[model samples]
Target: MPQGTLPTSLPADNTPKTYSGTKLVTYILAVGATGIVPPTTLTNVAAVAAAANTLTLRAAADTFIPSGSTLTFGTAQVITTADVTATAAGAAVAIQPAATPIAANATATYTNLLEVPVAEESNPTLTDQEETINVHGRITPIRVVNGKDMTATIRTLGGIDDPVVKRLITRGMSISPNNRERIIWLYPDGFALLATVNIGAPTRQAAAGNSQRVQVSANLSGGLFWANLNDPTPIWEAVNGN
Candidate 1:
């Protein structure tokens, strides 16, 4: 090495030095290992209906993928809400033991042993006051719009009578919509929480072994990358197509 022999230039000091912005960039990390998005709700359904597929559901239902497992799928599409009754082997989901069955993805795997019913275009509709409990827990897709700790957008329209599964978005987690309901993951987050995080009223269930065993991560207002599920720091991911 020589002295001031003309340095090989330099990168911007203000810009992130990483190759991609979609990595582990977080607005805030959860404490003690759980990715918890403190309960927030979307009281304005009219505000959400502004989009074509306001509730975009992923092809598969997975919160996190265990290490050593594989995520597999066929094609790729922007998932909104998938047809549960039309998925691969997920069409037989039952709701007795609190089993949160998961749908397949481009490369995601199932650690929990619940039979996930294929999410179909037609979900069971219930009347108000009628209990909409999931006979079997499902790994459905929930979303964090504008960083509402309590409320998220699902691929399908959450029925007024159906109990939905709510959790923080897995940081850096993604789903590849191979087709209508078959999907998998590319990478997997090590640890996660599989509890029933209630946002609104319907009593969304995700008990220990019920039908739902899902994972959730947090993002600020809307970066879509790293989010603070339980952090009340007023973060906001940019709302596009609004």
Candidate 2:
């Protein structure tokens, strides 16, 4: 919650918890029934099928939408629609708004959309290192692509035997080398990091009333350190059987 850099005080309990931020925003209306190609500047969305009534987004069911919710798109265009209920991934639903000719680069807004929260998170930090050299007794800066590292100590609030923690541990074991998820910091500007955890382990520590607590420190790496917090789209495309 510290703004404008320069660490005013120690990082307190204002940290985030473990969760997923995969959701859709708007998609490119392909040229099928409606021949409108949306602009590329849209966020949290992908190009849908040719059908204008149906919208397509990229995400898993539990990570994108765990419950039924309504989504609306665009104010005026070729096919202006409102309150379209999005229940399933890639499933089309009907809507009614106006038959005004939709144009290219048009976007829709969904106010009630929500992101899955991280169960328990703390000790969030962002570290960056720049490689510079001095030539002719003067500093000559050279740009390097070594991105920053984002790490944190995560704790499962449900104690040592939490189901979610066990599930995450199993998932980490299965997808160790190649897996990526977004870590979004819920700030006013919506900061985020696209990262993957190659190592995952849990430990039991003594707690109040002689109980045990489950926790682990996670190291997350990305192609780049920072990202648009609002968008949870994958940074790389995965090809099957390649």
Candidate 3:
């Protein structure tokens, strides 16, 4: 028997017509019967124009936007060529998002207060008091320890005219205990130690043609506790869901 073959060409349609009403809906619904149709990315979009707070897109670019749909820029987006395609001659300038509010942490306000311009060194010392109890019949002695006393010495290039340095000098000159302020020692590993401190008089060393060196000392009043560098709220407060 001979093998059968299929036709290579088919008959052409002489009449063409557009589908409308229920036929158009039926065709669309049939195409999307399996699942929702996925959206496609629009390419070669022109820059957006803004006039009096109204944004307009060119006619060619309008193909990507639906007639009655609303467009929203998200928090992660910035209105600029770097973020979006708006680099045309009169394109809208970049508008950055609003700054986020700082966390209400214990040491938030004091974070930048002690930012010395040319700080050289910071030395912190913590000392504990010990009492020895000697029993007459015992060969060994028992030691009882008290709380720690914390102190710090900060060294920086002396600039008497600098506002921060001047403030430190003025605070050190006060003899009243009520002048104590909260001081935070932030570590590179995201840990911080916060303490109520009374600043002592600063000592200055001067030499010919050399910048003066200033050493400021601080005596921690209520001791210190370690916490997160940015948000140092106490563990108990966090546990209570504050």
Question: Which of the numbered candidates is closest to the native, going by highest lDDT?
Answer: 3
Instruction: Give lDDT per model, in order.
Output: 0.23, 0.38, 0.43
Total clashing pairs for each candidate: 76, 11, 0
User: Candidates' TM-scores?
Assistant: 0.15, 0.38, 0.43
Q: Model 2 segments beyond 4 Å from truth?
A: 1-121, 133-145, 160-162, 172-175, 178-182, 187-190, 224-242
1-242, model 2: which lDDT tens digit per residue? 86687776855232232233232111111111112121222222444333455343222221222222223234332222332223224333343333433443344433221232333444556665446699999876576444455676655444323333454454345554532333333334555433344434656567678744556656664333344546666232321111
lDDT at 7, model 3: 86
If both were scored by TM-score, which would come out higher, candidate 1 or candidate 3?
3
| Per-residue lDDT of candidate 1, residues 1-242 (tens digit) | 77676678765233211121222211212212233322221111111122233221232332321121111111211221222221322232211221122223223222222111222121111112222344459543344333222223222222222112211222213332111111111112421112222212222335464443232221122222222345556243332323
RMSD, one per candidate, in order: 23.9, 17.7, 26.5
**What C-alpha lDDT, on a 0 to 100 scale, does residue 154 get in candidate 1?**
23
Candidate 3 TM-score to native: 0.43
TM-score for candidate 1: 0.15
Show model 1 residue runs off by greater than 4 Å.
1-19, 22-24, 27-75, 82-89, 92-242
lDDT for residue 41 in candidate 1, whole number 0-100 = 17
Give the clash total for candidate 3.
0
Q: Against the true structure, whose TM-score is highest? A: 3
lDDT (Cα, 0-100) at 108 in candidate 2: 45
